[model samples]
Target: MGRKRRLITDSFPKVKRRKGGPGPGKEDGAPEPGLRGEEPCEEILAAHLDETHLEILRQFDLNRHFGPCTGITRLQRWERAEQLGLEPPQEVLKVLWAHPEDPQYQCSLWHLYPI
Candidate 1:
């Protein structure tokens, strides 16, 4: 007789929040980083990301992957931006990293993807 195989989900716990970083949930009104206690002005947002950086963000956002198992390694630059009195760049990169299926991303892969 053949043995029956168990499903992966049956053997493992569902991962919710990322292991190291906090992510939004299935519901709306998720808290914005650094905005829970205060409102961030355009000037503050602009300081960290200028027109050029904004362009980068636009491209990055177009390529993200959503849901669980995603990771973002930006603490170092984020702290630097903060210490210099700047905010971290918006979650555009996260959005792009999540959904690589977008065609726009494929065109940009050569320059953006690591070797």
Candidate 2:
């Protein structure tokens, strides 16, 4: 008798996601408020977003978090978004450049105080 071959997919099963929401799970383009979490952020519910910002979001995260775009400062978000792939529009860069006071948001933002 021949041995049955084990496939790679057999080792990892895909997660079963709820049927709706803007997440990659069900919805295609934009996010709907998560059925489990708080109502989606105001920025998310707005019928229209700035065109350049819209382009940036579409490029930055296809599987975006359906929550507030807060916490991360505006500049940090744009800078980090570019690191992944796809540069945001030049207008975005210009706007961010005009405001240089943006503090970075990341795990390493705080250096330990010297003992």
Candidate 3:
């Protein structure tokens, strides 16, 4: 059998860590860089969310804990609901936005409840 030919390729690109300590779009105790110039959660919810979903969010005190400054992002909410065996209202699931800058609820928060 003939000897197999070898192939040469360029070296892999270097990976550089971000200047920030860790986590995406975060700095020390500062809001995410991408979230800058965005409205607070209250305003966004008030303006776009319907009364039913708003009321449901209120029932869980989600606004208080997960307000614009901090709370659960829409995606996280769905994940949390599944984790807690909760079936969130369809209307609540409909809430969407162009940005992922919304508040994020830590799973730990759900531990406080008896589920």
Top candidate on lDDT is 3
lDDT of 2 by residue, 70-110 (tens): 45544565566577564645565664564455332121122
Residue-by-residue lDDT tens digits, candidate 3, 1-115:
6997655543566567877476655567676543646777777677664554445544544543333212444556665665676665554455433223433222223444454
Q: How many residue pairs clash in each candidate?
A: 9, 0, 5
- After superposing all C-alphas onto the true structure, candidate 1 shows an RMSD in angstroms of 19.7
Better of 2 and 3 by TM-score: 2
**In the order shown, what is each candidate's alpha-carbon RMSD?**
19.7, 14.7, 17.4
Q: State how far residue 78 of model 2 sits from its true place (Å).
A: 0.7
lDDT, model 1: 0.46
Cand. 3 Cα-lDDT: 0.49
lDDT of 1 by residue, 1-115 (tens): 5988889789888766656564555345556567644656776676564545445644443443321111332333333444766444556445445445654432332334554
What ranking of all candidate models by TM-score puts the best one first? 2, 3, 1
- C-alpha positional error of residue 19 in candidate 1 after TM-score superposition, expressed in Å: 21
C-alpha lDDT of all candidate models, in order: 0.46, 0.48, 0.49
- Model 2 regions more than 4 Å off: 1-68, 102-115
